[model samples]
Target: MFELAKEFGGIQNPEIVVKLFSLTLMGQVGTSRFAICLKEGKSLYSKISGEYLETDKQTLFKLVSAPLLISELPDTKRYNILHDHLLKEKISALIPLQMQNEVKGVLCLGDKLRGGGYTQSDLEFIFSLSNLAFVSLENARLFNEELEKKKMESELLIAREIQQGLLPRTLPTIDGFEIAAENISSKQVGGDYYDAIPTDNNKFIITIADVSGKGTPASLLMANVQATVHALVPFQLALSIATARINDLIYRNTSSDKFITFFWGSLDAKSKKFQYVNAGHNPPFVMRRDGTIERLSDGGLILGIMKTIVPYQEGSVALNSGDSVILFTDGVSEAMDINGVDYTEERLESFVKGLNGKSASAMLSDIINEIQRYCTAAAQYDDITLIVFKAT
Candidate 1:
């Protein structure tokens, strides 16, 4: 016993421990054939040598609790099935591997090679050895799980850094325009994106998008969108043409399950004209100084669903002084309260109507505060992103 304990103390691999335990049991019991069955997570691990037996793990676990001869089993329907199976495989005895009164596994042994039945002393030794091996297997499983958890946490921290880098460090200071934007991710990394890029002709580009899912895959796709937008902005193509190109690239590269809701426009400060395209995105509200609202809704389908079947349509709106364009992802509108009701779009529009004279940054802050107050106790389930452009 002391030698067996010393041999198992240093091993951490479950498979190696099982192999050694099987060999030791066969040698100690003077048996040529044996079977070891242990439960691992949601599945069963079994090892058999010398003779093949079709063992039902659930049945063995349910019926066996103590050491007993297979021939001496009670003649009930359940026990009869196990008895017949053991006899067919020439198995003679059953010993349960237990820890703290709970059965963790079962060990089956065939008749001794020299022809006598197993005694009480032999059964006791076998039980003790089986439990010792089980303890080692459980420890190894726990250690591996901890290592996997740490690896995932490290990867998520790196992903968060990369996602932050993709956002604009400081929005461009466009003449006669006040711009403010904010993005708050959920517990996990999300795919909400917003950017403002300056162009050559006294104009700037404003874009916001929400990718379909969350986590590393979504962040990776968001990075691709950011790269594509920057690469195409230098050419100064029409909003319609650039949008079509982006749609085709995404569709050809990604699978059917992936897509993005996107909205973008070029704001010419001198002309005060905003030429925009909305690709299945939440239609941003153009709130006028007189409390009127116009929703920008003209465009093609969302990106990456399919190829650009029809050319995207472009819409243009002239921004007057005191007019505010409010853009946001679904996270803002779908935010829940303690009663599970959403802060709907109608509420958001009404709230914006009251903030007519507020600065762009103040409007952004008030909206964020309202959403946070509304969802005081409920957990946030998605990314919240908002961008406001006010004509000065």
Candidate 2:
């Protein structure tokens, strides 16, 4: 068995070694009552059969370390660990497969079938076999680990592709308004979303939301919200009803950790009336023609926080010529600079009022640029987004 294990171990193909070990074990047990315990003190493998047969690593480790496990083995002092006892008996190659200061496994051959204990020669043979087997096992383990890593990488790439496609590929055009939105996703996916939903003629619904958290779980919840809104919009239901259905759908579909701060509004082309609802979101700021600012904040609870919520009350503001509406995520107000001061709502208001007569696109760009300027050396804390509606 020792010579055969040595030959098989040298072969790069691990399957051949596995088969040899099994075949050897079957032969050993056939006619002898002798025990050929492996160096690791695992059950003896018969040379006649090529199989693992009966070796549990967990159980073997317990046997080697006393007091660590509940073992029924007798406390007889006569029983010695495979290596220590075999060395004392003078085996030629006690395959201290264990390296210097390293615990390579051990192999212990036992006495003859009808006899008392293992002879010196038998022990030497088993020691040789253990050294060879360790190399084979280590190689097999490394191969399996590499295989698993590649599999995970493939799946993650696919998940990222699907996420990108589902998001808005292009911003919708609003006749007299220039709008821009961005979702700088984290390494993990996010449920945070933005959209420019088309409503009646010349009227479009602009929305932005931070859906609780990030990742596959959040992405799934966001998908539900997008699907529900698109399906309900064509019916032209009241904003309150639309919100109500959305809330119910979210609450019923997700866990407690899942919720969304959503903001949506309809922009009337000729009337210049911006009707909006703020469902626990960062309010949209309107820079009035008179240089006064109004934070459009009237709606209901964040969706999915609970099973039922008060109808999202509709809020409206009539935009006079030259006024602009700025809708954003909390990421804006919360944006911090190197000094640790946040770019608060108060600052944003004063900043926009400064650009009173700017074009819609310019205002949007200016606002974003302002954030970057204010944040100076600090990175964005959350997903920063913005949309501008200009009453021309």
Candidate 3:
């Protein structure tokens, strides 16, 4: 019996244990056919053929307290009921396979092929063997589950590295300007992206965008946006004309459901003028030196929604010394607290007012710290992309 138990322990497939149980018992105590009925969602699967009956799982719960012998159970008693299931199938022994004091499955053995009843010693031996096999089967299931989880975590880490490589490694040093940007993802690789590309003649193109989805799909789409922007912006094309072409390209290449909220601008140090377009993005706050604020609300529909639905409108602002621009994704304004309340736009506007004369880097750090304090250690649920550009 110990040798048979050891053999069952080495088997990974749970169903194979039932077939082996039938063969091993036939030699010892004349039991022949066997079946394993396991819980499948709300139903019960009684065989290896994948057949299941539409029944409440509570019916199986009744067998957890003890093993049942078909001949010994009184058919007329309400508490000893088998529902005539075993009698109809000619099963002589039913053993509960338990783990953590809960029955995870049942082992059923039919009448002997030679036509004899199962003795008390035969029933006890089968019960012990079923428990041994249950341990092996449960361990195998948990081992596979752990392996799959590790594989997924490794893949997400790789995706995060690739996404980081896509962003600007170092911000371009533009004369008369101080710039800094940060992307703090919410425990996942997300769609928030920011770039500061140096264009011709001491001019710089700055952009911040958010893709429509989460994880790998969002990161891939953000990469596509970066590729498009890099390809078109260097041509010194009109901001509106270049933006329209980007919309058309994205519309043709991707499904209609995918879109990007984008905002990009070109700053010319000589002119100290910023030309920009905002494509259905969160309006950026332009905080002036005098503590007055301006929200950049230019451009048209989000990219990839349709091909040139509305001609993108170009907007410009003349930057004076001490003027600052704050750009961020919805992740900043929509961050949630432990109580599920959002850190809203009104709070953000008030916070920016307090840091009226701070440097770009200091302002960015303060904003992130305030957001963390508001959340009170609640897990961030989205990507926080921030950019601070100030005229020196």
- Runs in model 2 with CA error above 4 Å? 1-160, 335-355, 370-382
Clashing pairs in 3: none
Q: What's the TM-score of each model vs. the native?
A: 0.84, 0.61, 0.86
lDDT of each: 0.86, 0.64, 0.81
Please, what are the lDDT tens digits per residue for candidate 3 over residues 166-257?
99989988899899899987676678899999888889999999998777778888888999999998699999999999899889998988
The order by descending TM-score is 3, 1, 2
RMSD of each: 3.5, 8.7, 3.2
The parts of candidate 1 lying over 4 Å away from their true place are 1-10, 30-63, 85-91, 104-116, 290-292, 335-347, 350-356, 374-379
Q: Of 1 and 2, which scores higher on lDDT?
A: 1
Question: What does candidate 3 score on TM?
Answer: 0.86
Q: Candidate 3's C-alpha lDDT?
A: 0.81
* Superior by TM-score: candidate 1 or candidate 3: 3
Q: After best superposition, candidate 1 residue 123: deviation in angstroms?
A: 2.4
- Which ranking of candidates, highest lDDT first? 1, 3, 2
Q: lDDT per residue, candidate 1, 303-323, as tens digits?
A: 999999899999999999999
For residue 179, give model 3's deviation from the true position in Å.
0.7
